[model samples]
Each structure stands twice: as C-alpha cells, then as structure tokens.
Target: MRCRASARVDVSEACNLLCVDETQSEHRFEEALLRSLHQGVGRKPRFFAVGAAEESFDERWLLQVLTVAQQGDMASVEFLVRSRVNKTMQRSIRFLIRGAVGRFGGRFTL
Candidate 1:
C-alpha cells in the first residue's frame, strides 16, 4: 500500500487466489481495498516546533474515507466536504474535493 512493491505483492496474491478459485473481480477488488485499509497504523505527528503537524500521504485512509461517503455515511461525507475547505494536505484535500470524487463516478456526491 505504501509503495509499488507492496501493492504489486498484494495484487499478485489476490490474482493467485482468484486463479485457484472463481471469485468475482469486484469482490476481489473490494477485498484488496479492505486489506490495504486495515494495514499498519497511519503516520503520527512528528513535532519540530509548537503546533507543527505531520501530513499523511497515505491513500488507503483516503480510500476508506471516500468509500464511507460512497456508502452514504453522512458524518463521513460531511467530514470530506469540511476537509475540502480546510487546511488539509494538498494530496488529501485534492482527493477529498475532486480527484477521488471523480473516481467514485457519481456514486458519491458532495
């Protein structure tokens, strides 16, 4: 999830499983997303000065948040909208506002 190597490994494993059985592609894709979402703890703050903050470039949490919105979770949807206007990291804020929304293909709306 953090890098191409790990993502490749995950996809390879999922492909192996599918080849051994007859799992649907969508199911396998969702399983892969869930597996990645629940991986190790996200980055914690590394303070260098007062009020300094650490930004999480992790996309798994991003997908999880967006997925929640896509599933009709009001609170999470509100959070995404709020985050779009806040001082969130560029990576996450862009995804929150535009990128991931488009990826959701109208399944989720702000």
Candidate 2:
C-alpha cells in the first residue's frame, strides 16, 4: 500500500492491489470492502498526523496498528509500541488503543 510521493492513484481504473491470506494462496481484496458504505482503499483517509519531530510518520506501521486493532490484538499493539516507533506517533495511536481496550478488555502500555 506504499505509494511514492510523486505517484497518483486513479479510482476509475482497474484495481492493481494484491492481497495475501494464510488460509488461502490468493484472496480477493473485495472480501473486506465496505460495499454498503462505498469505502475502500482508493479513498483518502479521514485523518492525518505528523509524527515526532525527530521521526517521520510511518504509514506502514500505522496500517499494521489499525489492522491489529480491528482484530483486538493488544499484544501486537504493545509490541509495536516497544519497537523503534517514535513517542509522538505512539501517542497518536492512543485512540485506537483505547478503542481496542474498551472492546477487548485489555490494558495497554507505551
């Protein structure tokens, strides 16, 4: 899902996304599509934040955090916090962490 700064994505064109699943060799990306809401990868995100002054925001890590949050993976969230992540970005994920804890009943530390 990484994109170069100079690259632009067009929604009208055919999808070129590749998805992988452990249970199957190939998985259709549409399986996770929010058809009713007409929301998917091509759409722009609702929020954007600047990372710590010393470090740039890592979109890949943010995506991973979001995925694990949806799955209620508190351990993974903690592990990511303990990794080489910046303090500001770590703070930014608190809302996601809070939502996961509220739903899954687990504590989070950063």
Candidate 3:
C-alpha cells in the first residue's frame, strides 16, 4: 500500500521540514526515492562501493543513507557518519555520494 505525504505529517513536523502537498509528481518522487534506497534501482557509485565491501546488505544503513541523501547537508551528513551510524569509511563515503547523486543527478561516473 502506498503512504500519503499527509500521513507522514508528524515526521515532517518532527524534522521541522515543510510537508510537500500531495501530488502525482510528489508521489512519484517519493516512490522513486523508496525504490532507490530499498531496491538500489538508481545508479549510485558510492552505494555500489559499499555493496561491494559488505557481504550482506544492511537495511538500517540504507535508511540512514536515504536520510542523508534527502537532506543534502554535508555537515549533518558528516556528523551522522561520525556519530550516529556504525559504518566504515567505504560505507560513509558511499552514503555521501548517494546523497549528492540524489540531490544533483548526473552521470555518476566513478
């Protein structure tokens, strides 16, 4: 089942971020974001590097990565990498790269 952005109002409120109005494009964007994090559908060189290093995929790592990716704040990302999540440099770098890719799309050549 699909979740509405309205349904996540508390989440936005907690994060002090403005809630985007529900629209087809917004829904599509959210879905794409989900797919990229959950299924690795999008091209992310950093994520690829992390995947290469790990024997098994980590959902928690992916979620944290998604959070950083969505926020697009380098200082916050750096803080998250250092303090919050238990990840290697490879994984942290990948998360940073993935966040950048999410914010600014281009040929993620690496």
lDDT by residue (tens digit), candidate 3, 1-47:
35222232221122223233332233333333333332232232123
Scored by lDDT, the top model is 1
Q: Rank the candidates by TM-score, best first.
A: 2, 3, 1
Q: Each prediction's Cα lDDT score?
A: 0.39, 0.37, 0.38
The collision pairs in model 1 are: none
Candidate 3 is scored at a TM of 0.28
Candidate 2 lDDT over residue span 1-110, tens digit each = 22222243332221324222233211122211111011122233332344533432444554566567556777887786556434544432333333333333433222
Give each prediction's root-mean-square deviation over alpha carbons. Answer: 12.0, 12.9, 14.5
What lDDT score goes with residue 75 in model 3?
A: 68
Q: Report lDDT (Cα) of residue 1, candidate 2.
A: 24
Clashing pairs in 2: none
Query: What are the clashing pairs of model 3?
Result: none
Better of 1 and 3 by lDDT: 1
Which runs of model 1 end up more than 4 angstroms from their true locations? Answer: 1-57, 79-99, 102-105, 108-110
